[model samples]
Target: MTRRSASTGRWTGSSRCCPLKTRPVCRSQNPRSSNEPLAQGSPASCTAAVPGRERKSRQAGRPDVTKLLVLGAGGQVGWELVRSLQPLGEVVACDRRRADLSEPATLGALVADVKPAVVVNAAAYTAVDRAEQEFDLAQTVNGVAPGILAQAARSAGALFVHYSTDYVFDGSGHEPRKESAPVAPVNAYGRSKRAGEERVAAAGGDWLVLRTSWVYAARGQNFVRTMLRLAAERESLRVVDDQVGAPTSARLIADASAQLIRQALDERSRGSFGSELLHLCAAGETSWHGFAAAILEGWRELAGADSLKLRELAAIPTRDYPTPAARPLNSRLDCTRLEERYDLRLPDWRAGLMLVLAELARKD
Candidate 1:
């Protein structure tokens, strides 16, 4: 419970540190690399980790997408993907309110009803704080549902895309993690996401899993928006500054997913990417402190009010401020495969945040 200024890159007071002593932590405190030697800047680039690759084109006469289905349409990433994919086809988006994931029999039935050319699963149970007590629900939506949807996609002869979290890793790597890095999720939420990845992957439905980190959007209830709101209401706020990660905008995920989906469809004839996971977030990385500062800068520009002042923001380790789940210290993921396969080059997080918040300012 703290306040932050979207207009100024500053805060007052601080939160508590993490209680666990895992590894030498990263600024993001992703479950992975909690003990690895820390890198001071963006995670180092790594080799592509897509397990199977050999370029192939889609059926020669593959029609441009005429219909699409997006699950978890209300989530930040799902919301963005639905809008972005509209250009390729008729998008039918669904959230828990509109549909229930626990009843996969029902979800599968719904997919069949749509018979979409492409299926995007963006819905997930993301209450990391609450997930400690709701592991079953997280598994039901984040794990079980994707597997069922993949089956439906396979039966319908449609390509499937699933969104995952960086939480899948144990965060032991000092360097950025490759897609194939051994996973040892420290939290229940991470465990559920990893399970979903494995379940959907085993189902084998011409699928692509894109794992992302620190997801936020201007309109959504994300870190960026939360920090902004806090800044507006109070003089000081405490954030877990030690946790290092790339603050990804949902818009970026949507844009990259759309681009890669198109690439996968086109490569059906020479399948270079499929039934594999990819990393799709911003290019560079930063700590939560850096991200908050950037968002505030954008807010000021948008509001045309730079007069606001902020008290010194304090940074402390995760132990100082505990959450319900154990987050990975290094939330970083390697995107070389994504870059090579889709020819997509994502911008750094700061740049993307500015773009997102500028638009958010207009809305406010």
Candidate 2:
């Protein structure tokens, strides 16, 4: 089954990668086993076979298949994960309906049932401002649930992957924050996410926590889409310029995750796998006001200046635009560790924004 993306108008496979009701268990025909040694040479060469490893599956005959369970399949990053993880293994993608993170107790049963080789949790309570009033709900979903999921994955001998945010930091310094930096979340949402990270770590499992900043995608409610919508409605826009960070796309995050998964699986088989936290985001940075300008600029280049009502874009400091939640000024996350470890070179924020804008333009 397939569904059309509202933003891009492109047909994409359904969230469920395999029919769990009919098949019960889905497996890919990828010939490479977890125990197989990675190809020699650069990391690029080592992972080059990941997307096409299934070509020789028929010849190899019933090769080992990795079953991956992805939660929050309806989300932007989760949606992309369903597509990107297909080549790596048999994916059992579950939206909130199938796996509700709000009810953490139920997750163990689901994990036990699927018995996946890997468990990726992309679900979270992301309403930053609303979380101020509903901190309990946010904590239940973001904080408690991930720990439960991680523990379940540990019991099942499955590698657990979870996503965090730069909001975990207090945003005091101007420098890009390393993974080892002290965490001091400034808002309720950040506190909840920080709790989730600590819980996942305490669960004692082979887990990976990827901390990212300003995530957006073509097919979701994101900064890029929101900017486009506002441009179409308002003649002039006032955006906050104080907060700065890289606007990482969901597609990039999913693709990089698949690559990391492939490497981790190989290492796991060789008894060299270890749990770690890493920051992943696009290269470079920009303020929200700058990001808004870029979005409008990209839209104008793609759809023409006459297509938007946005004329003047004004920049204001955080003090000028106050909210219920206190936002961190510095949201930049250092990706040097992720880059060196995975041998991956992340694209610039502008490059990613342009690609999303182009996708949105295709729908028009």
Best by lDDT: 2
RMSD of each: 12.3, 12.6
Q: What root-mean-square deviation over C-alphas does model 2 reach?
A: 12.6
Tens digits of per-residue lDDT for model 1, 1-364: 0011211010000001122222122122122222332221111121111222222324543344455677656556776777777666567766544455655667767766666667888766665656678788778777787899998888877888888878888877667888988889898878888898998888886999888888776554456666666677666656566667777877888888877776676665466555788877787877777676776777887785643354545566777766667777887888888877666677878778888887877787
How accurate locally is residue 184 in candidate 1, as Cα lDDT from 0 to 100? 90
lDDT of 2: 0.74
* Per-prediction TM-score: 0.80, 0.83
Return the lDDT, model 2, position 217: 78
Q: What count of clashes does model 2 give? A: 0
Expressed as tens digits, the lDDT of each residue in 1-364 for candidate 2 is 0111221011011110111111121111111231322121211111111232332222222235576888767677888888899888777777655676767888888887776678999877676666788888888888898999999999888899999989989999799999999999998878988998999999997999999888777875566776778679878877878888888888888988998998898788778888999999999999988888888888999999899997888887878765667888899999999888877888888988898899999987
Candidate 1 lowest-lDDT run of ten: 7-16
